[model samples]
Target: MPVPSPYALLLSNVMVREASVSVLDSSTSYWDYGPPNADTVVVAVHGFRGEHHGLDPVVAHLSGIRVISPDLPGFGESEPLRDLTHDIAGYTAWLRAFIEALGLHAPVILGHSFGSIVVSAAVAGGVEASKVILVNPIAAPALSGPNGFLSRLTLLYYRAGRALPPKLGGALLSNWLIVRFMSLLLAQSPDRDLRRWVHDQHHTYFSRYATRDSVVEGFEASISADVSQFAPSITAPTLLIGADRDPITTVDAQRRLVELFPDARLEIIPAVGHLIHYEKPREAASAIVEFLGDGAVAVSEAAA
Candidate 1:
């Protein structure tokens, strides 16, 4: 059972806290590059169905910066949240704990796709980071209105999916079905390789824990997450990077995100897809380098 190349294994360690709470019960893996003691630290969070391997190249190109790209819970070696409440908010809390556990500075929090949702939640909840970068981020609509529809719909799907027998649940959980759904909903130009990669990631990482109940709970939590309250609270300078051709998180959504932040900058990458960080990592790293080089002041200047 060889896993996908984009999903390289990094670790299998767990976290156990007092009061019998096993904070992290799975191996936490990441694609770490750059100097450990570098003046600036950067943490990269992967998107839905994404793992650390996709970030390896981006992390590698970043020098003179301490980079930590962790696999999100249930998505990689990091175990799923107990009872399946692993929504974006729970993921944000877990990440904050992971950062504190490692005793690393807040540094620059960079998120791709779904990771952007969690990053926004973290920043809104007062997770101290020097700055923030969102690369082709998803969950943009969550920031504004008709806000409860997606979450409630997800909860409904989970309930419907679970009513069926376990054997039949396979269809709902099938990679083909999932990829098709994504192709129709998220990917504008769905190709064979991209479809295969999506399937490979789901099979390797989410197949087991992604039961009807868990997914339902995950959806319920994600949709119910109140990021609008969190968005305005963000004090860190924020940068939103979008791919011109991205289907998941479009340029329009990126522009809307700019309105939510107190201080934010938007950059549109041409000829790229949703995974801007993976597609042009060196350029992505360079953006961070430039951001870090000037401290928080440049972000204001750039935004203006």
Candidate 2:
């Protein structure tokens, strides 16, 4: 039997609820998990070409804290931004508004991959958060070599795809064969079953969640983003988690990020790649729970 799609499995789970919020004149869709009245609210953000469900595994292991994972505009069920650049600054602005609209004050902001960049930008712009957590955070250009080269190549291919008619371009970019091949190349887990599942999840989401314009814009934004410059402005206590085997964002890069922050620490997960949350959710959740401590508890009663 074939494995179930990630979204299908996610829907079957009871902890997750589909929700939406209006911000910047667009309806932003998201997944809300855990108790609504939780004292700790985690605004979880996914990577490029990713949807809220990508982080479902990690959220499953978390208790007490409510996790709100948004489908960043133009990526999942969320509506694309009108007449705005899909870069770090654009995302940062939207995030600020989204948080305020939801009445989330000093919520714990958790970002992964591209999401990390967004969180960093928001914090740098003075968006208040009690704490910030970056998972598989992308490094500065100076620290990224082979990964940077690959990213440029991807952007070039995306640009070429965009020049074609919408149908042809979309089909070319969303080809299952190409998506599966890329997934195989990116998989770094030693477990065969886990690798297969990750590949399946990537293929399913990449095929539908993104458009050529969004992909191109997001890639361009990432390459040009410089979060280090804004590090000193961030006052929130920060935790950085890096995967030992992640090629895109190395552990060394994560260390460099820690150095830039005023109050930050780093932890490296063993034998995992960039998809640390999916590959080792239990371990990741444990580290996060320990870091958050009593702050993650929903109620004073739960804390005791």
Candidate 3:
């Protein structure tokens, strides 16, 4: 049996708390893990079609420092922005405002998949962060990825969902089979149990968007921007946790993308695709713990 992760914190534990904060006139629901008093705070952003719960696997492998994972506007329990387009600019602004609202002081910022683009843009555009971490970061355009053809089909899927009437659109967007199919293609876990869990996760939470517009617009936004655009401006040291078999950006692309940053290191987990959080979360967490240094342990100790 695989060893239990060292920095591990179980998701089922009662220690995980739910909290909320108002940002941009909307209530953002978040999951708080680790000690509330832990000085190092890492605000995590979930991927497209994902809520805070999606990062539970990776977060479970991390402790000592507090992690705040919010459901992006319109996903999970969060409401959509009052009057902003759901584009990169809107998300970038929301993330910055969200952090400020929480009174975080240069907390480490982490993002996964679609979230990576948002965090990268926010950090590059001047939302302060002590450090940066990108999991399965999108290095290239979605339409130009290794799974370019499938991505194009997915673009069509989103467009179709938007064009159809509300009931039909929501039905199509929330189709369980499609979710499982997409999950299968991207979830490269060889372990059957892990694969089943990933499929279950997608089935349970992947299509929980508040509105058809939110899902469609978010999909468009996700494919529209990538970390490459913000890499050069992110002055803080960054870590990119990549996968050798990632269906979207290849490890080669990840390598090239890391070089563009002023200070960034790439960690490529083998035998996994985009779902590093599922297939190889232990490795991802190990890389992050090392990048963060002693769990930012000094902060809590100093405060004490």
The prediction achieving the highest TM-score against the true structure is: 3
Each model's lDDT: 0.62, 0.78, 0.85
Better of 1 and 3 by TM-score: 3
TM-score for candidate 2: 0.90
Residue 190 error for model 2, in Å? 2.0
Model 3 alpha-carbon drift over 4 Å, by segment = 1-9, 296-304
Rank order by TM-score, top first?
3, 2, 1
- Looking at model 2, which ten-residue stretch has the lowest summed lDDT? 295-304
Please say which candidate is ahead in lDDT: 1 or 3.
3
**Pick by lDDT: 2 or 3, better one:** 3
Looking at model 1, the pairs that clash are 12-27, 13-27, 15-24
lDDT of 3: 0.85
lDDT of 1 by residue, 94-178 (tens): 8787777677777789887667778888878778899998777663554344434654565565667677788776566544666
* Candidate 1 wrong stretches, greater than 4 Å: 1-27, 142-159, 180-212, 225-229, 294-304
Better of 1 and 2 by TM-score: 2
lDDT of 2 by residue, 167-228 (tens): 98888788888788778776787877778789878877775545678777876777777556
Q: Candidate 3's error at 69, in angstroms?
A: 0.5
Score residue 298 of candidate 1 by CA lDDT: 14
